[model samples]
Target chain A: MTAARAQEPVIVVDGVSKFYGDVLGVSDVSLRLGRGVTGLVGPNGSGKTTLMNLLAGLIRPDEGRITVLGLSPDQPERLMRRLGYCTQVDAFPAGSTGRGFVVHWLVASGVAPRQARRLADRAIARVGLLDDADRRIAGYSKGMRQRIKLAQAIAHEPDVLILDEPLGGLDPLARAEVIGVFRDLAADGCTLLVSSHILHEVDLVADTVVLMNEGYVVAEGSVRSVRAELTTHPLQVLVRCSHAGRVASQLVARDDVVELRMHADRGGFVVSSRDADRLHLDLERIMLEQGATVETIVPADEDIQAIYDYLVSGAGGS
Target chain B: MSDGRGPLLPAPSLRLRLAQAAAIARLELRHVLLSRRAASVSLLAALPLVPWVLAAIYGTPGRASLGEDLVGFSHFVDGAVLRLFLLLGCMLAFAGLVRREIENRTLHYAFLIPVRREVTMAGRWAASAAAVATIFSSSTVLALALACLPHGRPAVTAHFLHGPGLAQAAGFVAVIVLATATWGAVFLALGLLARRPVGWGLLVFVLELLRPMLPLALKRLTISWWLTGFLPLRSQVKAVVGIPAPPPSPLAAAIVLGAVLAVAALVVAWRVRRLELAYSGG
Candidate 1:
């Protein structure tokens, strides 16, 4: 799937903006996605799914244009033939067997009958549900249901697979297995846009990250770049102890400890520093010398949650 | 494959859309047959007619009589049963369609397909209509066959015993089916257009039933006007009722019903096209 073909940007969403009456889904969000996996990450309402929908040709953008594989989404004919969308919402007809459902999608994707069968089996097996393929979808667990959706999306070998929260409700093991499939898809140069609130999930699979908040693109760049922008200040390490002054006094000597705030409880103090190594060394040495036992060290270097909170609360203007 | 030219069939792919719709319809049919609720409702639908059928067979003034009075009497009974059957069938079908989709949220799978939303809708409509048609046709056949049995009333069998009479009876069945199909489309469209199609259908049904009494051209506002116009039998009899009227030409009424159904189906298509897979708050 990868080696024989030249890389091409299959999806181009330029200045795409959409307002659902009053609520905004995506605002002035623009990105050119080519082969490989791109993770769409943001807080719950951060327009990640909106951006994906825009690119998938599910929703028309009010202000900007979107092209999927060089076709407008509004023009359903040309665009949908090549696109496969897995919605964030996990739903399937209750009565269909997994194999029946997968076969239906395979046939629907325009695969030849023989090819459809082969593809359906391959996709079902790809999702690691071959044994359960004949089981009724109604009887399948949520994890199994998710895999069924995945099988449908991949059965046709779509050029671009746009998934919204595909990993939701899966156990850790299932999540890993699904993530592995996503990684394989990316490695095969199949363009994939995965929208998830889990930062580590995205961090594991995507080279690029698009961050949205309140229907606007707060940030869009390489994962490293976004991580760097999020890492403006050093992690704040709050150490709890009986002698707060003693801990603060030892921390003040090191240049690495840039900011210090005494804990309100007087039992500990919070120290901010970019260098984790120096902070840990300083804390260890100071606690040993003072014979003060450190209760806890909490490093808050704009954890994904903090970044998400900032994006959400600060989502004033798109 | 043409250079910069749009393909006749668009995204997600037509093949997938058809497959998805077929799968949905198949699942819906299975649900209709296997569901306990569906079974009970279907049983209830057929329940009320049993006593009326028994009465028509045994309660006539004389057991062996064969004459015009029996024909008139049979027409009255048959007409009432036919109307009741269609009305209940339409209501049940419409409510069933809306409730199932709303409860299960299974519509999400269909929404993912690239075909026009109407295509998916048409598939479901066809599926339901096929089921309903089968049920009604078999029931009518059974009713006709039973009417000919030895224990059946002589007047009932003697009236419809001949070939031409049987053909006319078949024609009557055909007219009833055509009318029901048009109403089915209307109801199915209503189901797609509203969240509570049955409630809305009832409200509209009551309004249509009463609207005919209003002055002049307003009578045309009711679907029943067109539907009744197509019936083989007239609602009122001149001797029994005060003012009797001739039945309208079935051809003209069918044309009108067909056109209205087409327009309603188009509206359904348009509504489905705009539909989102959101569970609620659309």
Candidate 2:
């Protein structure tokens, strides 16, 4: 999926903006998403679901153009075959069984009933819901309902899968099961765009992250690559030394160490700086000269949470 | 693949699309059958039986055979049932066909189907009409039979199956079917056009009740005018409701009703083609 994602863009949104009368939905959004699981990470009302809805053809953008798989969403009869969208809204027609919900979507999408039944069984099994597949959806637990929604979305084996909050309401066991299914789909070179508010959920599987805040993409790229490019944001680092206050005082005068705070136990220091290499060299010199025992030095901003905080706060949001 | 073109799935033929629509309708009909509103419709359809039951139990009791009462009551069911309760039942049956799904946020199941939106609407329309006709027609048959119950079993059996009573029962059944078809189409369109179609349904209901008092030109606009035309003219109804001109022939009345139904279908198709799955405001 990583090799394929670099080839070409499958979905193109060119300067698209949507508005609901006096309220702004999403404004001046553009993206060229390719293959693999590109996670859309944002806070509530940050336009994550709105962008997903736009690409899924649930609502039309008031401005600009959107093309999914080279076809406009306005032509759903054609585009829907290549794309499947699993919404966050957990709803099904009343009195429908789990198998019936999955099979109904397949048969209504022009698959023969015989094949639909087989695919429904395959999908239910893929989600590890084979045992409860025959139970009515009304009787399903929250995790089971989430699996059924995933089953229906993937039953037809579409090329582009857009899931909004796909991991929500899942227990640890079911979450592991569905994550394995997503990995398998990606292994087959399928394109997936998943959205979730759980940052760790995105960090677990997504190689590329689209960080959004207040209706705009603040940053998008591989998590590590995005972190590397945040040169302006002070990189938070932890220094575990015997004399944390003395080390912090000696290193605080350097140009690279913008701010420093002694650890609560006085055994370490937490420093914020714009440079990594120079800060590490200065810390080593201070520790060696002052006879301080340096246990460990860790760059805390090398992970997804740091990248997310930098970009979201960089977009003028806390 | 490098040119950004995704694999285009094979398009389904028209024949396959129709089959898909039938499958969707079959799935949707089961839930609709158990909806709270469908129960309300059934209760309303059977409401027409009430006044007649009281009349048979308490009105002018004598040596008069209830077979005579059944025959008389069966004759009046077409005008009364079609004019009042069946229309309301059919309206309830179809008003929630698509609108309720949108409100409940389950409409997305239909939106992503690999067929035109109109096919789905047509399939649901077919199912709703079938259910409404079946429910209301059974109510009419049962109410008419109640009228024949006072007579002995021989008289009741003879009147219903072996004589003109069968013909009368069939006549009322046909009127119920037509009313469901006409008003079902009307209410389904209103469901698509307005957020609160029941509010609009009140206006249509008022127009239907006032049909007899309006001029002939204004009367023709109401579905009840064409529906009542299918009945054999009753002098009592005509004297009170003032049927100034003779009703159209059964064939002419059907043709007019069919035309109205066609327009409703057209509006449904046109509206569905542009339909986006945006839920209404809270």
Candidate 3:
């Protein structure tokens, strides 16, 4: 766990289980999210959306309790004022303009009409949709729709934001811009729980991560910590050198090296090491003793994608 | 985006909730007033005026005097406008209050707001009732005016000024407003509870049509029975074939209508409290 998790949690879930009849939505899930972006990473049907919905009070857990900002999800009148959710559902009311949609929500939430317009404009500009603010949402492209949804979610300037795939359907530039916005919100002390299938993007924006699979939280924590906790699945490292067979023969004998495979090109070898820090320290000595010319030493499994893959693919063990 | 305004009105006051509800009502009013459904309901509300206009322009066979015309108009208002047109119009307007949002997948937008669900339901129902009531009430007035058009100015003026014409017009407007309030709530509740609210609305329409033939106690259970007590002209029941039971007193009618409205509102609040955005199944 990161130091952020040790802070006063703004959101707390305890033994939360949700079901749609006999189909499990999320089960036995527990989490504490403090200030900053906590990425909810999961494959499809992995209960990522369901968990977000539960926190946003869109759906209630059949068997557990959740509190956001010390208030229960059931108390929407109190909870929703401090919370904002950008749902995955893409549909909007027919004939609504982007600006009007945001303003309508603000007004409906009791913001004064004049202030709602001002805030709407600010939010539209924040999402970089000022050029299309007055345009009908039905005429917008998918990426623009995503931006408008984000604009509405933040128009109220909520204390806690729950985003379900807020980055879906955006181009690389827009994605980067939105990630910058997420960082800005987190910097302002907003607690954001964002869900995304794009594991690497989550890695970029989230301070901590929760990995869910098949209706369960398989793993969660800082990316490095989660990787460190998976002892069974030793960290994989790609080592490029002038002599692959020599490096593999030397590394395979080490106590920390669990497995080694020479690259197909015979110019490099992939080493699985239980102790990555120790492996890194010995790499220079091993290269010097063999008179090997080392090119690259990259930890292949240090990022969220590899961690997600290992955890989700069952290679890391239950 | 945080202007550092601190948290939103920490505990929303009653005035704040009312403001939120009013805002919702305004938004819902636009949807109910501008849609194709509104056009069809407006046409239905004005349908009773069509015959009156035709009769005013071209005299009918054995055209009756102004008094007889007024009687015939009241029966027409009772049978055609209130029973058929207004009933269907309220069904069209109110049953779609929640269902339309679900169909558009926009219900979550309202549900996510800090306002209470009960407040949202009240706001939507109020807007729909206002729209439907205004349409039918205006049509009723026009129909009454056209019914007296064939008569000379002195006679028409005397009918409205000295006779029961003005009273009948006021009574029709009041009954229309009350009927809209009560029936709108019923249909709104039906929209929340039923998968196919229109089908359930059809069932309600049939039951109302069969109300006059039911036993007196059962007749008291129908909305039309309580509303009939408020009609100024008694000719509507006199024209019917059976020996209709005595109508309830105006106070009793008001109390009964209020009770039905309260019950329907309670049902709507109960249903909306648990309403989830399961748009996929819908």
Which portions of model 1 show Cα errors greater than 4 Å? A1-8, A54-63, A107-117, A229-231, A234-318, B1-31, B35-41, B60-79, B95-100, B148-161, B207-243, B280-282
Higher-DockQ candidate of 1 and 3: 3
Question: Which of candidates 1 and 2 reaches a greater DockQ?
Answer: 2
Query: What TM-score should be assigned to candidate 1?
Result: 0.76
For candidate 3, list the clashing residue pairs, or say none.
none
Fraction of the true interface contacts (Cα pairs closer than 8 Å across chains) found in each model: 0.19, 0.45, 0.52
Instruction: Give the top-scoring candidate (DockQ).
Output: 3
lDDT string, candidate 1, A1-318, tens digits: 344333556677888877788887777877777667887777777677667666655556789888877777765545665667777665676568999887765544344557667878998999999999898988988888888888888776666788888898789999999999998876755678888877778767887767676676776667545544655546677788767798798788877778888867788877888676677887887788888876777755334444545455562212
TM-score of each: 0.76, 0.85, 0.93
Residue A100 displacement (Å), model 1: 2.6
lDDT of 3 by residue, B1-282 (tens): 233545753358899889888988898788778878779889999888888889888966346788777777767776787778899999988888788888888898988988899998888888888888988999999988888888878888998898877888998899899999999999999988898998989988987777767788887768887888787775344536443787778889889899999989899988888876644220
TM-score of chain A of 2: 0.85
Q: Looking at model 1 chain A, which ten-residue stretch has the lowest summed lDDT?
A: A309-318
lDDT of 1: 0.65
* Model 3 accuracy (lDDT, Cα): 0.85
